[model samples]
Target: MSSSRSRRVEYDRFIPFRSAMDMDYARFALTRPSRPQRDGSRESPSSVAYQKLLDDCILKNRSRILAFKTAPEAPASKLPQFDEPIRPQKKQQRRIPKEPERVLVIRGLLDDNVLNLLDWGSNNVLAIGLEDAVYLWDAANESTKLLQPAEDRGPITCIRWSPDCAVLAVAYGNSDLALIDPATGHVVDGMEDENQAPVLSLAWRSNSILTVGRFDGTVVDYDFRKDDMFICFYNGHRRGVCSLKWSGLSGRYLASGGHDKLVHIWDACMPVSRHRPRQRQWLHRISSHTSIVKAVDWCPTRSNLLASGGGCNDHCVKFWNTINGACLNSIDAGSEVCALLWDKNKSELLTSHGSPNNQLTLWNYPSMTRVAEVSGHSSRVLSLAGSPLGGVVASAAADETVRLGLLQHRYTSDPKIELEKWCQMGYNADTF
Candidate 1:
């Protein structure tokens, strides 16, 4: 925590943020609204019915946070009586389309033990790992090509783009990790875990540092620039870490959820290794979910706000205000929450689900109201990624198809998008 609020600039003013990982993730996970947003802006209803419901919500939940505002200005002198009083009209928000604008049919989505998530690069490229290969698809033109074909390494477990958008971190089913340049497809660095267990999840802490959560229940941090490489070790989680997300704020908090049905938040400042091993080093050991916690994300704008989703058994999504390890809000999702993404441009959140609905739900934040639902995937929706320009979101499902939904059409040139699905993972099955 900073000493004063004055030190904190407005959100997205990360030109001076200390950690590169914080800046990188904030840019990648957030929606890039082209229109400049004024500080303490207000939301206006576009329709009467919606307005009435919104007003009701405001009245019912008076204590809930709806919008941030500054002090009201001193009132001007009463307007002189006129034929009709002129009033300023509120700008209404553009409604996000309910249907997906484009769809891509590709297979091998159920790659061996891999996380069901994709990453969007600063270059507007979407990285999707098939059975054993990593493919990059350009969202602008819908052209895709194989970036890496690691047949012998086993199926890809996880792929993440570095904060600077220069290198791609790839994890394999064989527990092999590598950093490769997306431009030349050259392996910049590679590492092999002593334990044969594969990496269940991974997140880049910075351009040079990568944290890996393994099936063996080990969390290790590697600094590729160092001669030893493996610089730190974090101990926790009795079971495999299914999801890992480094807080994209100060890079201080590391949140992870796994098969153990527990979510843990660790402080990077607490470097616990074998030599100086400390018990219960985590800042918070959250036991809120009854089942596996696969979906977890740090709020893009709020440093202390974190969201987590539970598995089928629990079917719950919880929001934590990390300040005192207190639960701020919890919602029971009808289906299993497979993934969570926050719409940073607006006070909204998006989640992908499994089982009953396999649909993507858009939610209004603080209010915690369902705004829209997008259905396209025939199976479980595994991954969710937002475009860098902020209009569309890319989702991958077990149905072996990737669908792009137009969230804020006004942020893009048009709402019409075309995607031709083509992946070589099916033919590369032998690679496993």
Candidate 2:
């Protein structure tokens, strides 16, 4: 039986990739088809044909494969050996964050007193503080001087500088107004008066001064050129009047907000008879704040839009339509607002809280949502202003610092350098 099994085994194969020791593993087997005779006698021609077809198919597939079972062996030779295995090298990488072309900038110092109110006149600004002193700042030159009049009997409550920056109107917590020439740091004249209550807000129309206060709850018009005497006092607000602003675009309309939680619009003009300074007839009385309205400002671009803020005893800043007194939008700041500024270029609303928190919060006007908040001040923030480019914002607080920065960078290039060169050439021509 062993002899018969040995004769039956077929071997024409190659070994698998393993150590060459044990050779009894299964190997490839090659089979040859049995040829048929021309005379088919008791055997089947169909089986022979089928076997030949299967063998041909197997040979065809084997030829297409890349790897083979059998190959000629290489000659033995000595080669260099690497002690370390081939390892892939990793490369170092660096990632950088993108920076803005123009950054939002803010910097400032503390004020000696809790600034009651703030005002901007042309390239200058005024801050009315606790000592009946009105501090004027030259915005372009970054200089400041205190305007404390000889007759200042009470703390300055509010200030308004003329649009042309020719004269500065000062109002004390008590009834009085001082017109000062910042150029000479002297009182202009006829501004000393003690008959009215504290002037809460100051405004200017054509060459005259308009002031609002609690004495009569009326709008008082003062003509400093004609005389120190009052021109017209029109009763408008039922309660104390606290805020007033002129339309920078038209210079024809005046806006005032009062403790009555209403905003009054006045047509600023001289009456036909000139008896009253075109009486402020209270065109629109807007009511949105539940408590006293603290401040109000007319848009510089459009004469029909007004922005107002109130210490939240009402909790929000509101934009109102000047003609219809309709509330357009409200931003919830969650703090008592002491100051608010409208950045014309970026359309951002900058608000400062008086108490509870001394943070300055910036809001996107279009979205009516808070965008960024600065929490560096330890005291209440009283005033805010944005640069023309709208890249930087300046805020004044109970702490005494005036901050300046880029609102937006037109470019890293200096805009003034070229202008300076042109000016030098012009100077040389004039000298010749």
Candidate 3:
């Protein structure tokens, strides 16, 4: 009956439920759908409005829905037609030709003597020094003629043709050097030695300058134009100076080897007055050889490159960079390397062997691979010379025979081609 009690009773009556369990029936009745007016009934206003809202959303986002189904692709190039013509690739061929023919041969050269008696002249004439006689064989006509007949002086020790091939420098056992006319076969000039030792080796620097290697281990350069006066004198080898070569490419460097097991590279332009009594104009005193160093030659193409071979005790072919006196390469020749000749047209080297093999080997220089081995001499092969016209090599042996044969040129044809091939394989020139 109080005022607060009357307000609480009025609130409870308006709310109609005192707990959640009392409102469950009303909540279920509200969620239940109304009965349809007929079998095919129309949609309610709220359901119609929700359907219309979905339709509106789809119409507004039509481009976005269609964009996922119709994405653009990358453009493609047009292909060739089926009837188009195709091009063919070209094939490569070998560069070097086949082996050359064996031109000619001469027998009974020195009667089984191991001597440096064979020399090929630029005039296509081959000179052979046999005991007391020196014969000139015309390679073109296949004829032999005596340039110097048997002399009283010691048998011919060495013979070298002048650069012009017009005169011959002959060394006799009587310690005499004679410049003879090849046409007349007569001595035009002569020089007598004081020691009377045999001149074992001879090389012509020019038509006027002649270099002689003596058995007394002396190297003397004589100027024939100046009354055969000695212009330069070098004494370094303790034994006989057996080999001497003036570089044809540089014309300023001279290579000498001796029986003393020494290889001396001399600069001809060096001043002799600057040295002492026993000292000489030797640029490099190379002592790589253990035995007699008899075979020495300058590379025809490389100015500062030199090649030398040791005797039976040391059968090695050594290549030297003469500029710094550095040995570039050393190859065990398996036998005494008696002689070496460089190819004129290719990067090849021909070496003659003695003792066991007695074979003539054609090598790809720098590479040093033996390309061909020719064995015809029954004795020690001593000397080798390349033809001035190229593609031929003449070798002389202790068998008393001179053989002319073809040197293989397969891998030595062109240096540029070899370089290109090496580059493709990741190799350089120094790799050899």
- Measured against the true structure, the TM-scores of the candidates, in listed sequence, are 0.73, 0.62, 0.70
Arranged by lDDT with the best first, the candidates are 1, 3, 2
Work out candidate 3's RMSD over C-alphas.
24.4
Q: Cα RMSD (Å) per model?
A: 21.2, 20.9, 24.4
What is candidate 3's lDDT per residue for 304-410, written digit by digit as tens? 99999888899999999988999999999899888888777567788888878788877888999977777867888778877665666777777666666545334
Scanning candidate 2 in windows of ten residues, the lowest lDDT window is 95-104
Scored by CA lDDT, what does every candidate get? 0.76, 0.59, 0.73
State the lDDT at 271 in candidate 3. 66
Q: Which of the predicted structures, 2 or 3, would earn the higher TM-score when compared with the native?
A: 3
CA lDDT of 163 in candidate 2?
A: 61
Model 2, span 1-432: residue lDDT tens: 255555666779754544432232113332332355556654567666554554454332232222334444746544323344435666634211122111211222224222235555555453434354556555445456766666636666666667677777666655666777878877775454466566666677765555545534677777666644576665568876776667878877787777788777776553434465455466676776777675566666667888888765876788987777788888777877766776665566677776677777667766877666666556666666554333445566666543333333331256455233223332121100
> On TM-score, who's better, 1 or 2?
1
Q: On a 0 to 100 scale, what is the lDDT of residue 377 in model 2?
A: 58
Scanning candidate 3 in windows of ten residues, the lowest lDDT window is 423-432
What is the Å distance of residue 129 in model 3 from its true position?
A: 1.0
> Candidate 1: global Cα-lDDT?
0.76
TM-score, model 1 to reference: 0.73
